[model samples]
Every structure is written in C-alpha cells, then in structure tokens.
Target: MERITERYRLAVRALGKFHELASRDTLNEIERDALIQRFEFSFELIWKCAKELLYVQDGIDAASPKKVIRACRETGLLSDAETEQALKMVDDRNLTTYTYDEAFVASLIGSFPEYDAVMHSWLEKLK
Candidate 1:
C-alpha cells in the first residue's frame, strides 16, 4: 500500500511539472496540447492527494472527485472559487479523456493560468 506521504510527493511532482510548463511564454499547437495533458495529470494527482489526506488525517473517505473536492472545501482546504473551478476541471477531465473538441480544448488551455493558480495554491497548502 502506498503511504499518503508518498502519494503527496507524487502529486507535488506532477503539479511542479505543470508549473514548469505553465511558466513558458509561448506554445504552439502541440505544446498547448501537451499542457492540457499535463493539466489533466496534475489535476488527477491533486484530487487524489486531497482524498488521501482527508482519509488519513481527517477520517473523511471521499471517494469521488466531487466528494473529495466538496469535503476539502468544507474543511477550508479549498475556497469557493477554487471549489467552483475544481468542479469545472472535473467536467473537463472527462471531456479530455473520451472526447476531442477543439473549442473545449482551447477553452481549457485559455483557463490554464487560473487552473495553475488553483493547483499551485493546493500545492503550497499540501507542503
């Protein structure tokens, strides 16, 4: 079984990579596509970390993304704005996985900075 600490470290690493790509000033189609992919990965890691932390530290077994995010918000780990954004990201996660729409992809790419900021905040809190 993976320890929560180990899971957190992996989450942090994914978030860091997302930040690394986010800091870049320019990206062509492929790079932007890559960024979206990284966003999906980091997003998954973050919520999983949140779920694990809540389970191990708070005895709150939130099993789904919505449950975990809502619990985190209730515990003050996530803000209203962040909770809202996290929900949106969760929706996008599904879209990114099974569906491919340029508009959906573009919208998510455009939201990268905000998304990155939200994830960055969680990273700091986890640290």
Candidate 2:
C-alpha cells in the first residue's frame, strides 16, 4: 500500500543518516551521543515500517520490535542469523537509554555498522 511504501522510504532515509554517523572513524562525545540517538530513531522507524508492511502484505500484526523482527524471519524477510542479529540490535536500541555510560555507548556504537548493513539489506527486500 502507499502508506507502507512511504513509511519504508522514510525508514530508508533515517537509516541513511544512521549509516553516515555510524561510519565515522571517530566521534566526539557529542557526536557519539548523536549517533546513539540516530540509531534509536532509525531502529524505531525500521521496525514500525516492517510492522506496517507485514500487516498490509502478509497479514501479520506484530506489536513490538522483537515481534516484528521474529515475524520477519518466519516470513522469510530475514534469515535466521539476520533475525538473531536484529534481535540483538533491538537490545542495543533499548540500551541506548544508557548513553550516559561511556563504556556502554562505545560498545553500542561499535555495533552500528553491522546494524546498518543488516538494516540496509532488509530494507532492500522490503522495497
């Protein structure tokens, strides 16, 4: 549906911004925080888009990020490995609330590149 398509496009664009920030060689504390925030929003948009597409295209009505991601795997939108990674990504997204913890931020930011790659691949399938 047009709504799903529009949401997919928006999620893709947000992921693009996340990819840009995540690809940085070094970010100051502020930039690192920005990256974390970007990841949070990007993850949110991507999962919601997935939820919408699953509902419209596949008759699934996943109510949360993890559910949407799991449904994605069951529906062949994600491989088992990708599903595992995405589930971990969801954890990372949840942990973003702890951005004040320097160690946690560093660890989470390190995972962004992989998240970006997986998200891009999944978005392509949605497209």
Candidate 3:
C-alpha cells in the first residue's frame, strides 16, 4: 500500500512537469524532444502506478502498460473512452522509441492536451 501511494505521488509530480512542457505555445527541436522525454517518463510512472494500485487495491496484477490500462478501466479508474485514448497514448509512447519523423512528432505533440487531461483524470481516480 505504501509502495502504491508513493508510486502514485511520483506519477502525479511527473505528470505535472509533463503538463508544464506540453502547455508551452512553441518549442524548438530540443524542447520538443525534452517534452517527449517527459511524456515518456510521465507515461511510465502513471502506468506503473496503475499497476501497483490495482494490485494493492483490487488484487489485480497487470504486467504491462496495456494490461494495466485495461485493468484500470475494469477497476473504474478509467472509462471505456479514456481507456481507448490511453491505449493510443501507449502506441504514441512506443512510437517515440524508433521514429523521428517530424510530422509524427508534431501529431504526437498536438495530442498532449488530450493525453494530459485523461492522465490527470485517471490519476485523480486512482486516489
């Protein structure tokens, strides 16, 4: 339980930083890359937080991001629509690993607002 709480706190803090970067009106290449990195960090922490919370709160033991997300929906931490968006967020996070296409980067960054909103809502429910 303590571990779950700690993870949730960390996820919230990291998401706050991600939200700060995502809210910026304009970013150069370096800043854009930094935002993506922050997204990666925030995404990781949040999903893992969900995993831990599920285990501690609901006796669910999801082992992957997608699984954790689906479990979150089952636990009422996420709605069906938010779960779908989160799955897309997972795909975007994975894409950040190997792709450097500028167009894709722009599209991903443009998605930050939605991502940020859903993530925030999910975290709120986790508490």
Query: What's the TM-score of every candidate structure?
Result: 0.91, 0.95, 0.97
Residue-wise C-alpha lDDT for candidate 3, range 1-127, written one tens digit per residue = 8898899889999999999999999999889999999999999999998898888778998899999999999978999999999999999999999898989999999999999999999989888
Q: In each prediction, how many residue pairs overlap at the backbone (N, C-alpha, C within less than 3 A)?
A: 0, 0, 0
Off by over 4 Å in 2: none
Per-candidate alpha-carbon RMSD to the true structure: 1.7, 1.1, 0.8
lDDT of 2 by residue, 26-114 (tens): 89888887888888888888888899999988899999999999999999999998899899999888777754686887788778888
Task: Provide the lDDT at 101 for model 3.
Answer: 99
Order of the predicted models by lDDT, top scorer first:
3, 2, 1
Candidate closest to the true structure, highest lDDT: 3
lDDT pick, better of 2 and 3 = 3
14-66: candidate 1 lDDT, tens digit per residue: 88888888878888888877887899899999898888888877899989999
lDDT of 3: 0.93
The 10-residue segment with the lowest total lDDT in model 1: 1-10
Clashing pairs for model 1 are none
